[model samples]
Target: MTTVTTNKSEPGTTTSSGADLHLQNISKRFVDFTAVDDLTLTVPSGTFFALLGPSGCGKTTTLRMIAGLEQPTSGSISIGGQDVTKLPSFQRQVNTVFQSYALFPHMSVLDNVAFGLKRKRVKDTLQRAKAALAMVELEHMASRKPTQLSGGQQQRVALARALVNRPAVLLLDEPLGALDMKLRRQMQVELKSIQTEVGLTFIHVTHDQEEAMTMADTVAVMNKGKIEQMGAPRDLYELPKTAFVANFLGKSNLMYGTVLEDLGDAVAVDASGHRLVMPKNRAVAHSGAAVVGVRPEKMRVMTLEAEYSPSANMLTGTVLDASFTGVSTEYLVDVPGIGTLATFSQNMGQAPAQRGETVRMTWEPEFSFGLDGNEKATEGKDAL
Candidate 1:
């Protein structure tokens, strides 16, 4: 059963054309498992918010709840200050573009985009659908059937179909998951541009770290049915509060250490008997044990005899292996007691380090981040 309710704005909150989505204390349980646990968030109007996590991390469940596909076991959902907790999916001012384009194979691209508007008895359905197609740069493909279009084009059709309704909030459930790597990257750019042009609240659920970081203004990293961290992509990438965020978002080399001293603007840590310093503001731990982390790309790798800044944190290691990954060379270095660490050095026509060759790794203290001592160093190392 579906119920229609008038839009109601919350006191002291102004309603905008692009609705601000609020998920308060939301929880969802399925028989033996909890999918979403007490998740609370507020996506600002017209913002591109990404729920990023690996599969089974509750990101999809959360999106399903927001789109009215699943009713929360507890808590409330509101958009533009109007409570839609009990409303059916169709009754809410929301539209979704799923991984599976879900276009009508028998219908032309234009008709597929216009289907929803035609059903709603919306005026000038053709004109509105054409406008939506143009938004995705797919207006010229309107006469073709979905079977005749490329995966990328079909994905755009799905986007146009959902967008034509002019929903207050647009839900993108891995909308680019089906496209190839190159096409996915292209679509990511197009999607962000479309979102900017329309200025609508876009709640994108994606497992691709680069996709989330590239497109979202804000990304909430979820784990085990809860959000581990939420912030801007750069913030989350550079200063992750947890080991999971560090390893899952990008390649991070973590070294377990004990806090030796607290210096107002810096913290000293003893790792494998070697002293290291990290910016105090970046340290999640100032006392006891700490996990010092630096992204692979942040560390510079050179021969052991190379001159390095005296203030930089340095480690001597033997090269375990090296891989040329097009733009950069990735080196796996074995630093005795500290275990293996990875470093990425740009390919500037320099000789690649050889296996078993002694090397030195150094990075500025400011680039180092700290995580709580107890966080498992391998927490999200292999996530997805």
Candidate 2:
């Protein structure tokens, strides 16, 4: 796996046949509003990088700029060591596989894959197209028309079409958005494997968090045209840097609090009349107000009558709702001053707590994270 870096690469040092993609102080402004702010990023050669965000978050615009389909209103774009900001789409050595697939119904799969090569007057187009189809495991369907193929098969053909060109960079703009859940997941694995085998720099744009996390080596979460957070999937989910990331990437139970004490190794916060503690390294706000957060799955809920560990951060509340989803039971508990907090308990055959039942939720203090108190608590609520 090639490492994804935000730092600029040195001149004359090409990491792979595939080029590193860089955007320096990029911005796109429309007459009505600015679509992308001053954004800067570097995708290392041969890395599977994902630009993830909700709709209108400038991910697509960014992909378009990279593909030379749209020009940045300001800043520069470089692939490898060459600037391509003003180049036409065809001159950029970049190809895009869009969500719509854009296949011609009249053309056979082989013809579709060979179209680009044929347009470029390349010799041995048929042979290269067949090789591409084989790479996608659709060589047998080469002679079939796209209209006769399933959605997944067509998507693969679309991929094969783009791969046959051997572009320096491949941009995937929600390429699997149209596939059903099962096929989408299956394609995610296939796409990752194909990318690994080919060692091509891929920039994938998607709104689905699962899609981004499942396939990309690095994920950049965008909000309102700026990257809110960027990191490995596990790191971003475990230690979010902002309230928007914590809430949008997954479910986080956050409560407003004020920092009370800073122990050498930890920080204590008074949250809703309860003293909660988090590791010092995990605290973003050392003093004044803060937002204390924990993932639902990390919290353990039980009846108040049960014995509890004195060192754990504990909250007593009444169950507001309970939902059973086979593998785990999700409970919503209403704690005084803190509002409702969600908890997920694995179903170890014990019955789920009933609504209105008094319960105690406890978790290790180390599992908690602290964010700035000024951040909007619902900044990214229901974003997914």
Candidate 3:
């Protein structure tokens, strides 16, 4: 028989707000191909975390391991202090919302939600299903079949189905991938609000960086079967640990240069023929090759007619192209020494700089990051 348990805490008792999830040295292999390699991560209780990476980067594999749907070659999985590495998918205190809603076409919304309880032979299946529908604000659609519902409605049914189980954690695999841009944005806000209301631990997997940034309280950037970096969205964007994380998470303008001097808390780089000083968190290899990374938004374009000194990290270039996005203006500047730099400016009722106009680009020193290798620089140059 299906068992439903109500969660309760004493009225003034200090209730712990979150569940704790831990994965230790998780590794999975498919014959000669290793899908996940020595992956370890700790997700705090009640946190909405995302595993983000391109396809075949092992994000889905890691989620499966956590769900107990796939056995890891070596590792341990724990949820709320209980070891669940050897448990079956059904035995784990977790639920999953797959990409496809997987609703029954012929069944009413009520019957579709009652399916889980019915499979387990719960005594009050109908009552529980109604309550679940209410949780997702779909109780009024109880008699409607899956075909009668909108895409967002179907997704809510899936969420209601998963939440009805009251699992300690919820795993979602690209649940919004199928929706259109407008609907996707709407769902992002809805999902985040729902999660906050329920205070359930959620681990979502996706290749869309914006989705991850928008929905997750914490983000793990995965690459080549390994987690490159993990942190809050702002932290990862402002202080990226690696070049791959910087480039993959958002658009960045990478430059090739050699370190000219290490100025205690900052390092000066000779970018092509121009010298630029960047904030240094660690002592980078001085007097050697380096790569400087800067986000496109960090650059501001100034025409020759505009009044600005060349004291900052300034580069003169011709505007190769200008594209007007509603919220911002994007420019492609062809500079003599550093090649072409992609620049962006906010659209505050101002006209975009005209193409082929000579403009000066400047950025703050703190906005640039210095890395030792030339791989990212080479890749950026090749892309242009």
Please give the RMSD to the true structure for each candidate, in Å: 4.9, 3.5, 5.8
Q: Answer with 2 or 3, whichever has the higher TM-score.
A: 2
TM-score per candidate: 0.95, 0.96, 0.90
Model 1 scores a TM of 0.95
Better of 2 and 3 by lDDT: 2
lDDT of each: 0.90, 0.90, 0.82
lDDT of residue 92 for candidate 3: 92
Candidate 1 lDDT over 1-384, as tens digits, reads 111111222222323457889888899999999998887788878888899999999999999999999999999999999999999999999999999989999999999999999999988999999999998988998999999999999999999998899999999999998889999999999998888778788999999999999998888899999988888888889899999999999889889999998778999999998788999899889999999999999999988778999999999999999999999999999997899999999999999899999999999999999999999999997888
Candidate 2: give the clashing pairs. none
- lDDT of prediction 3: 0.82
Task: Give the Cα error of residue 273 in candidate 3, in Å.
Answer: 1.3
Please give, for residues 1-384, the per-residue lDDT of candidate 3 as tens digits: 111111221121233344788888888999879888987777777778898888888999999999999999998999999999999999998989988988989999999989888988999999999998998899999999999999989999999988877789999999998888998999999898788778888899999889999988788888778887787788788877667777788777777888888788788888889888888773234558877878899888987777764556877899999998878999999988789889889987765789989998888888887666555553212111
Write candidate 2's Cα lDDT for 29-147 as tens digits: 99998889998888888878899998888999999999988989999999998999999999988999999999999999999999999999999999999999999999999999999
Clash pairs, model 3 backbone: 18-45, 19-45
